[model samples]
Target: MTNYEVRANIRVVFGDGALNELPTLLERHHPKSILLVSSGDYVDDLGIGDAVRQAADSLGATLIEDRGVVPNPRLEHVRELIETAKAHNVDFLLAAGGGSAVDTAKSVAIGLAAPEGTDVWDYFTVGHAVEQVPTLKVGVINTLPGTGSEVGRSAVLTNLATKEKFGVEANNLRPVFTIVDPAFSRTVPQHFQAAAIADEIAHLIETYTADDTDVDITDRLLEGALAGALTNAAKYADDPADDNARKQLHQISLYQHYLNFDRNSDWAGHPIEHVISGDYDLLHGEGLAIVTVAWLRFIAAHKPTKLVQLVSRLYHVDAVTFSEEQVVRGFADHLEALYGRLGLPTKLSAYGIGQEGVDIVAAKVTAGGARTVGNYYALSQEDVRALLSAAL
Candidate 1:
């Protein structure tokens, strides 16, 4: 048997009307002041703005709101929010959107907690230790699904200056509380929802393939997440408004992080996807839909056994033996078709990236004297180039 660690942190409040209970939970936390963060005007448009404000007023909690977060939040935005919160003397942060919003809040938490004279970006780029670092009480009321940032102990931010996107992971960076309500996700556009599905699928597959060692329990957990995501993906296509389906997808999104037995797993496509999306401003999931297939295809050639095992678990196939070509092509084609059914792009070209971006992305991934990503087969710059070229 191999030794490992697993996390069962984060108090989860999940349901259809979970949003209505947000105020109750906030009161229990008893923060004196709060910073409410969202990506756009949806907080007001969806009536959540008023609900949370009323909740804050009930407790006499000072509420300051900011709508500056963007998809794949930039480092500059995080710094600005941290400064704003400190200026307002906000004692708590309420992230009321999707992963980007939550991630921005987490970075805020990290920044607030960091020792004075330390920059938050140092944690990601320079390996600054966040243990016992200063942090604020944080909570979430998430909209949309995928990007396990809601529960995962990581916050990703992009430095537009360097054209690089990276994440900082520390135990305290995870949300103190996460509220998952399918109702909040009901209005997400179908295409974006599809992109979210592709993202969750990549999350599961990356962790599932991170190790080849036989860990029966972990395998079972990952398999369940992948299967549930696929079932719900189909359900979502049929009716994006289906609460039950949305709930399942949201649960699967959380499970992506929940099943992370090891804090670090082989994130096969993320570094590549991050570069592509950060450079060209493409949807993270849409880029993953393209990069993930290519990443897996390259991995399949090198480790067909693990590739087949991954596919068998994901597709619920009983085939224990699969040819190299069969496994790669079959799994790639299946995933591509699923993306197609969900209205997600099957290639980087669909997002306006081309052969030109391949070298730039490869260079970005290898910038700062670094190479190779993931545990399955840490990809070298050449390997990354080939992977992107294949996707192109």
Candidate 2:
């Protein structure tokens, strides 16, 4: 816990009727045209796309709406979007769905400003110079509170050619503004909602356990953020229209992202999970929920105090009464209870990724240039294989 600085740049407009503020927000930016990106059919079903169109139209800007973003957004699609924005000479973007949509829009913002055909992958791949580039102004109307992509200066996209899911973060990735109106989540189905909750928790876990130097302020803030996310997520699971619950979930997710957790292993169950999604198209959060339990259990002894801290905060349990090992397993049990409550998958087997799939996943992670994963344990390829087997 040395001296450090974290940047919080995106202007966030929260609470109900926030989407209606879009028109006025756009008026300030005053762009000639806007590219609206959405995740899937659900956005149309929920009327989110229409809402953005209405706002963009009222603002007198041509809105080029595309609902082509996939679950794991692809690099080719990003290039296509850049071309679409270029063809229309669109100067602004509105990400109107969840992480995929927001990430795609973010990629487009960077791509359109880069030298033509610069391959968005170049920004993320090793050995390439990721120079600062011009980018479009952006706005967000987020549906899922998962990836924090709305306010984050990062975008994740998969390359089917390489069967890899990678992320790029740059100075230009943050949105100019975001309107987190959870009213849009009122009709979201259970599975997707559960996965988002899992993702939010995963972010909290990564930051909380990544380092153990007792930055008490950071620890408590991360702990509180996890508590808020779980409480509201449980409320929404019981009744989706609980606007208070939804709003709290939105607020808590933003709080979690505001911490700026590292993307490495102990910080994330993600590296292990990323390869799973990259190979099999599993949802990112679902994989995290599945892998995190195994990861936490594996590292519990290595980072006992922090694990105790996390268990105390997330489960509201007395970690002091238990031995280090008991506290560790208790955390896993508590996570299981939360997962069951949210209807999240408990094992890789649930996704039909059996023994052979586990081998493939480990091989991919090792071949993907990760000599080690996580900050605390820094598991090597062999350790990752063992972790994958444990997850299985």
Residue-level lDDT tens digits of model 2 in 191-214? 877888888888887877755464
Model 1 C-alpha lDDT per residue in residues 1-392, reported as the tens digit of each score: 24566554677889867778877888877988899999778778777899889999989999999999888888898899889988988899999888888988988888888787989898878888875786787898888898877888888888888777887777777787888877888877787778778889998888777554556677788888888888888888877778888888888877787666643467868888888888987778988999888877787777767667767666655564757657767888878887878888767777777777888888778763376667778887778888888876
Best by TM-score: 1
**lDDT of all predictions, in order shown?**
0.81, 0.77
TM for candidate 1 is 0.94
Candidate 2 runs further than 4 Å off: 41-47, 127-131, 212-214, 261-265, 313-321, 368-370
Cα lDDT for residue 228, candidate 2: 84
Which residue pairs clash in candidate 2? 206-267, 265-374, 266-374
